[model samples]
Target: MLGRLDHVALAVPDLDAACERYRSALGARLSPPKDLPDHGVRVVFVELENTRVELLEPLGTGSPIARFLEANPAGGMHHICYEVADLAAARDRLVGEGARILGDGEPKIGAAGKPVLFVNPKDFAGTLIELEEA
Candidate 1:
């Protein structure tokens, strides 16, 4: 149902600063910022040899990332994404196991323009899990 880790998403208060830190300090390759209005986040992907790191900043006051920052101030790890061959099948399997899916329980277009679904954090031991279609 799950494949390799897709990317680790970090909610950041300042998107540009975060990108600079990864680009200059860590010497990481980063994708240009992309505004995901549907997700209410401005995102940039730090490309790596094995995996990618997604940096998310609030797009609006109502953004979920804004709420997250309100709680953590400095921002922090928001979720971990994993790849799945069949998103609907994986979703069903998770539902059968009583895992709660966030939003409408349907897959939405993700940063990679792939179908993605988010599972409730509580179900995954306080870590939000994102399932992206491979």
Candidate 2:
């Protein structure tokens, strides 16, 4: 059902400062930042051997990340992304098994130009689940 732990997304107030923190203090180099209009957020990917870390910050007040930050003052892990072989199939299985899809239908182009889908935590035990087909 899942391939690997693709990435862990962190919701931050400032993307640049966060990237700098990861790079300078943590000795990490992010690939590049990308703006995702659909999600209304900018993201930077910290590439690793088998996985990556995604830094996500809201681009506007209406952005989902912004809303999440508002509720969670100390924004931390936003979601855990899992690599999937077939996104459509995985989505169907989850829905059939009673998991609610946070986003409609198929996945859309998200941060870093990757296809991404969000599943409601209600069905996933309070964890925002992200599925990315590799």
Please report the candidate that would top TM-score against the real structure. Answer: 1
For model 1, the superposed segments whose C-alpha errors exceed 4 Å read none
**Each candidate's TM vs. the true structure?**
0.93, 0.88
For candidate 2, the lDDT comes to 0.85
Query: RMSD per prediction, one decimal?
Result: 1.2, 1.8
Candidate 2 off by > 4 Å: 112-114
**Whole-model Cα lDDT per candidate?**
0.92, 0.85
- Cα deviation of 6, candidate 1, in Å: 1.3
Q: List the residue pairs that clash in candidate 1.
A: none
- TM-score of candidate 2 to 2 decimals: 0.88
For candidate 2, give the lDDT of residue 51: 83
Candidate 1 displacement at residue 72 in angstroms: 0.8
Q: What's the TM for model 1?
A: 0.93
Report the C-alpha displacement of residue 35, candidate 1, in angstroms. 1.6
Worst 10 residues of 2 by lDDT: 103-112
